[model samples]
Target: MNPYLEIHPEVQQALAAGKPVLALESTIIAHGMPYPQNVQTALEVEAVVREAGAIPATMAILNGKCCVGLSQQQIEHLGQAKEVWKVSLVDMPYVISQQLDGATTVAATMRLAAMAGIRVFVTGEIGGVHRGAQTTMDISADLTEMGQTSVAVVSAGVKSILGIGLTLEYLETKGIPVVTFGQDEFPSFYSRHSGFGSPLRLDSAHDIASLLHTKWQLGLNGAVLVANPIPEPFEVPAPQMEWYITQALHAAAQQHIKGKAVTPFLLKYIAEHSKGESLEANIALIKHNARLGAAVALAYRQF
Candidate 1:
């Protein structure tokens, strides 16, 4: 066992018993959402996972421990805590060594989930190539981590605020398969359609499980991106999302928000501008992904 890893008893038991276990990221609690809603959504998502017949292991860092499954109290603390370190791949070691309260980004979560032997991960959205990356070169570490980590990520697709097309291209270049669930078109986080064809498509948890089994059986490395679309009724229209994103981007620039701070800033901006509709959409998609992740984890265990 890794000394740095503090696996919750429930998660440990599930893993040892060969039962399904779904890994969930914690950035959503620490920096992604606001106040009581963040805590509420975190608890709700865990329930969704458990209802699907799997254990939910929410990953975070607290007081130098790499916590695999946080309790409800820890979730609330992370949600209300200010200035929590949004730890990614590069910052993970520093946060742990320094005993800082840290939230795991997609990259950090995937890395730690793989370390803890959890194969399926759920998140609202995976970061990607930021808009105008040619000059700024502001690609997210999530992409790089996906290219190496072996966990299967269930998400609503890349944030619409990013270059979705470029993100797909980058994933392809990295030899990471991007499989859309029950859809031929790639989703755009808040929207159901990104106007791009997905590289692959799978309709059921069994299909995804089989694909993952085959891939790893052939000695393939890296993560499988399961792009689960946001539920249609909850989806914000592409045009409306585009407008909101543009407004948010302009404001980010004006405020000089850069680096890791950019995403949380933009998400809050969009939520506020959309009159909390975006936040609702975000919570909905994450819970939806949690269900799928649990199902996939169960199916994977069969192989």
Candidate 2:
């Protein structure tokens, strides 16, 4: 009942009843995909979470209030809304103060999820150290939030446009646990392989839940990253995806797109150049993560 927060009744009940609840980000609806598809995917992901035995709480900002779960109408409006702010930690205050609509990035989502006592979050992928970040000092706020928050994030992986090696190293320095699900090799968001071995791998939701429980029980702080690979049929081969990413990155550079604009710009470029295949892969991976997130939340409830 805080003035700045609004929790949907279902999500509130789940929290009060100790039932499993999975938190989802809103940037995927507002800035991550095209209109109808964004709305469609949002609905589908919610359905997947419910089927997997949890309630879905898709977080966003509406009229300056942080909303923990969006209704169907709100989801549609968000997907079609104009000039919605892509909100991260730094943008939260401004968006709220201005009474503007805002889509929650991974960082913003994690922060709000922690505020609402929701421990499991699902998203398409995470932002990471941008390529050439050594020169630009442009690492994403998502990494910083991971170091400070307690939510467990289930994502496809780091967005492939980023410097994966550097991002992983930064995570190591911050002591964030990155655990790959089912595979020993970490995934690149659009593809099943990143050619980099994961530092840790847990094959099932129960195992992931156990790890999370133990970490918190031992008084460990910060988030747990669960990298879930896209299903094989939807995965673009690593080599092919790398080529597409290169083209998209170059295009972003040519357009002088940086900061908050970089990811959506790069994703749009890849989606267009790849004849919509990349978008398909993106949607598929989100659904996959939603399922895993729900399972992990359910299992964690028992801990």
Clashes of each: 0, 0
- Alpha-carbon TM-score of each model against the true structure: 0.99, 0.99
Candidate 2 error regions (>4 Å): none
Give the Cα-based TM-score of candidate 2 against the true structure.
0.99
* Per-residue lDDT over 1-303 for candidate 1, one digit per residue giving the tens place of the 0 to 100 score: 999999999999999999999999999998988899999999999999999999999999999899999999999999998869999999988999999999999999998899999999999999999899999999999999999889999999999999999999999999999999999999999999989999999999999999999998888999999999999999999999999999999999999999988898999999999999999999999999999999999999889
Candidate-wise lDDT, in order: 0.94, 0.94
Model 1, residue 186: C-alpha shift (Å): 0.3
User: How far out, in Å, is residue 4 in model 2?
Assistant: 1.0
CA displacement after TM-score superposition, residue 20 of candidate 2 (Å): 0.4
Measured by C-alpha RMSD in angstroms, how accurate is candidate 2? 0.8
* Per-model root-mean-square deviation over C-alphas: 0.6, 0.8
